[model samples]
Target: MTSNSPDRPATAHPGTPVRGRAHPPRHRQGPSPEEGELLRPLTRRQIADRMGELGELYTRTTPSGRRKPPSGRPFSSDPSALLAPSPQARSAAFLRRLAEHMRRPGFELLVAEATRPSGATVLTACAYGFPVLGDDTWWQELDGHLPANLPDLAAPGGLFVIGDILVERRVRTQDQSRDWNLARRLQKRLLSDHTAAVGVTLVDRGDTDTVAALLSWGWRCLPSADRRLLVLR
Candidate 1:
């Protein structure tokens, strides 16, 4: 049931050719309100097979903000911080990270697609992450210490890490009315499976816009050791 999308930039990962972006449905005209999106969980094999599509999506959503860590810091201790790869390398780096993340037990991915009046489908957004192990081994990657309660929260295995959330650029443009808040919706749906778990996601210490967006969406900032990373829950 793989589908392809049109209208995205033609960049692709080195060895993996970009075989058309996955549209999920085509953009239609008229004042008709946008339809609700379908959200579904993806198995590891399904996600691996769609690397080409996901890679393109990642490249399209790659943040264009500053890649450097705060002054005097060497990019938070998080291995996920790789100075925001150049446009040419974003696809490859993203795929590599996705591959690594898939190896973790309980890792999961969810994708969102919308149906147009013509009945075409368009891939609108996606989010993925896994439960934080009770051992707290994941904490070692942070550049700073966590709040006192964070460990206690994770101790019970009631913590989940949302690694990434991405929405198509056009979706945002078309959603200027704020009616959908698709990104927020994607996150909420993704976290629903964890039921009451304190969800956390890391943002590059320099990505102020994303941090602010998270805040607007009701996420709280958890203090860390330094300015290299901001943990939002």
Candidate 2:
């Protein structure tokens, strides 16, 4: 995708070195009605179709050789890896500009996380008034903290706005299988619930193959758009 600014260079190109900590690209302008028309409305059946499409894309685009490091590595184990400090600073700056575009009142922000958050990322989300939804693991820990029954994926009001997509891949311990059916289930539920408007930030162990395998299940890999919403500075 082309950067809106003529002066800025494109971030993704063939043979670019992979940064251990890459800042998400800037957000493209919100999808126009024409583009929105292209996306099927969120429905359980449609969600399944999208998931299949994503899975096929992931499998086809990612090769098996590009596997991520083992879970014991620093980046793989640390939740903070989801947010690089330098990228966070840039993201904060971007948020300021984004706020200008969100002039309508009563917009509520939600930050979805697949695992426990780092102190820094938590602080940042709080600073921005974004409600945190710690999926699966976090939900289990804090489920008691929320209401007895959280509503299904329906946006509470038309006011729901996702600030970022956080992808967290769970490592297989000795007892845990490498299978990712649970992750795929959660991903589909969220996507179907939110429609395709929510921006997703994929946080994995930098395993392109494994990540691709997960993405193949139904996740969209629009890094550029994610960068715009999640990365601010």
> Which candidate has the highest TM-score of all?
1
Q: State the lDDT of candidate 1 residue by residue for 16-89, as single tens digits.
A: 75665565575554342424677888888889788888887887775664467558766677766855667668
RMSD (Cα, Å) for all candidates, in order, is 15.0, 21.8
TM-score list, all predictions: 0.70, 0.23
Cα lDDT of model 2 by residue, 1-233, tens digit? 74543342468566775456446667764532211111112333332344433333223322333234445654455555554335334444445533542343332222222222352311001101122232423123322433222312213421123332222333111112222333333333334454433323323334444444434544444332112112110
Alpha-carbon local distance difference test for all models: 0.69, 0.32
Distance from true location, Cα of 227 in model 1, Å: 5.5
Question: Considering every candidate listed, which one attains the maximal lDDT?
Answer: 1
**Candidate 2 segments whose C-alpha is farther than 4 A from its true place:** 1-37, 49-52, 62-64, 68-136, 139-202, 207-233
* Global Cα lDDT for candidate 1: 0.69
Deviation in angstroms for 163 in model 2?
A: 13
